[model samples]
Target: MKVMNCPLNGPRNISEFAWGGEVKPMPDPAGVGDKEWAAWLFLEANEAGVVREWWCHVPTSYWFIAERNNITDEIIKTYPATEVFNTRVEFAAKAGAGEKK
Candidate 1:
């Protein structure tokens, strides 16, 4: 079973989460007009390889997390939903990886 840790909600089953698609190019609300906003909200780029994504924690109503390179079943950098602003992605420090909880 795959597991993920939401910064806001803490560790939880990955199945409980929902993929909101690649998290990139957050449209500028002040700069872009309504038309652009509409597209940004409704449309998705859907790029491949090393992409940042927004994952929703349904069971826990926490901030969305921005994961990187989310292809296949496993996604990297499952961080707090609020820490989305962190430009640098720190891969999960799992056991054997010298990461102590």
Candidate 2:
């Protein structure tokens, strides 16, 4: 059986995890146009070498990062997202947005 080491839950069955996507710098949602936003949301680099990606532990709903080689399909390492992302970005609500009439 395949195994994956989750940062929060330790080693577990690969079935217990879900592949989120490649870890990339998020563009400013409010500043980008429809095309740019769409690309960011749907597109991927699909690189061949070792790439960092986001993964989730389904049972615990815990998300973390994994570095794996696409060609070899080998997981090089895994770690908590906090190791790469230390600061949180807050998006301010627009004026008169989502208010009842």
Candidate 3:
């Protein structure tokens, strides 16, 4: 069984965590075309070397980042999401846009 180090909870069973997805930069939606938006939503590098991704501790609902090797499935390091995703970008709803109640 694989073990993953949780930034907040320490080391734990891999089953206790969820793979959130690869960590990537969010594109500026207003300046990009539909194709770019679609790619961002659907595509992943899926590279064979070390890749950075997001993982969540199921019990605590805590999310963090992990750097692991895709080929060997070895976790290199883990850190809080804030360390990498420090900038928060807020997208304002445009006029006439449907808002969720």
Candidate 4:
């Protein structure tokens, strides 16, 4: 059984958590067309690499972000949702610089 570190609950069984899907930057909902909104809502990149995702602790109903490598199934870190904006910004900056974190 895999164990995941929950930001609020420390380490716990992976079964106690729910996969909340990938974390992507939100586009301005007001400016996007229906097609764009639909794509955003339904489509997933499913990239084969390190990706940041949202995970919810089912028992406590706490949601947090986890940076994991899809290929290896290794979780690098878990953090609160409040830190997501900064994490996304940092990830974007690294990508823009042609660097991987």
Candidate 5:
């Protein structure tokens, strides 16, 4: 069983959660052609490596963001489930490693 460390609530049970969609710019619901709209609806980005995502707390009815390495199921970070995801990006930029973003 893998453990995920959350920002607000640390070390949550993975089973008590649900996987949401990709944390990215979704397609514009308006101002698009038929083909573009269909593509957006069907196609999605499954980015490798450090992929940011949303998750729902099934047991608690809470939502949050998770920074996880998809291939390994290694959760790197977590944040409160919010519409504006700028907080997650800001935190990542500050927590620097060998290189900077």
Candidate 6:
């Protein structure tokens, strides 16, 4: 059976986890253009060899990072997302969404 080590929950079955996506720089939600935002959300580098990706432990709802070899499908390492993302991203509230016209 395949297994993956979750940063918070220790070793677990691979089926208990979910592959979120390839880790990439997120564009500014307010400042970025629509096309650019769409590209960032939909497109991926899809490169071969080792790549960093976001993964989630389904049972615990814990998110983390994983370095894996896409070509051979081997997980090189796994760690908490906090190791890389040190800051929390706060989004500004939309203008006049709740106010009466």
- What TM-score fits each model? 0.63, 0.91, 0.90, 0.81, 0.65, 0.91
lDDT of 3 by residue, 5-89 (tens): 9999999999999998899988996787889988988899898899999899999999999999989999999999999877878
lDDT of 1 by residue, 1-101 (tens): 77787777677887888877666666654467789878888887767666667788888656575656646645677676455575644444435775565
lDDT of 3 at 58: 100
Can you tell me which runs of candidate 2 are displaced by over 4 Å?
A: none
List the global CA lDDT of all models. 0.69, 0.93, 0.92, 0.87, 0.71, 0.93
Question: Which digits, one per residue and each the tens of the lDDT, describe model 2 over residues 3-33?
Answer: 9899899999999999999999988867878
Candidate 6 accuracy as TM-score: 0.91
In model 1, the clashing pairs are 7-80, 23-52
After superposition, which runs of candidate 5 have C-alpha atoms over 4 Å from their true positions?
6-9, 83-101
Clashes of each: 2, 0, 0, 0, 0, 0
* TM-score of structure candidate 3: 0.90
TM-score of candidate 2 on Cα atoms, chains taken together: 0.91
Clashes counted in candidate 6 amount to: 0
Give the worst 10-residue stretch by lDDT in candidate 4: 86-95
Q: lDDT of model 1 at residue 72? A: 69
Candidate 5 lDDT trough over 10 residues, lowest sum: 86-95
Summarize candidate 6's per-residue lDDT along 1-101 as a digit string, tens digits: 98888989998999999998899999988899889999998888999999999999998899999999999899999999999999999988888988998
Candidate 3: count of backbone clashes, pairs at least 3 residues apart or interchain: 0
Model 4, range 1-101, lDDT digits (tens) per residue? 89999989999999999998999877775567789988888888999999999899999999999999999999999999897565333222323576556
Question: Global lDDT for candidate 2?
Answer: 0.93
Q: Lowest lDDT 10-mer window, candidate 6?
A: 92-101
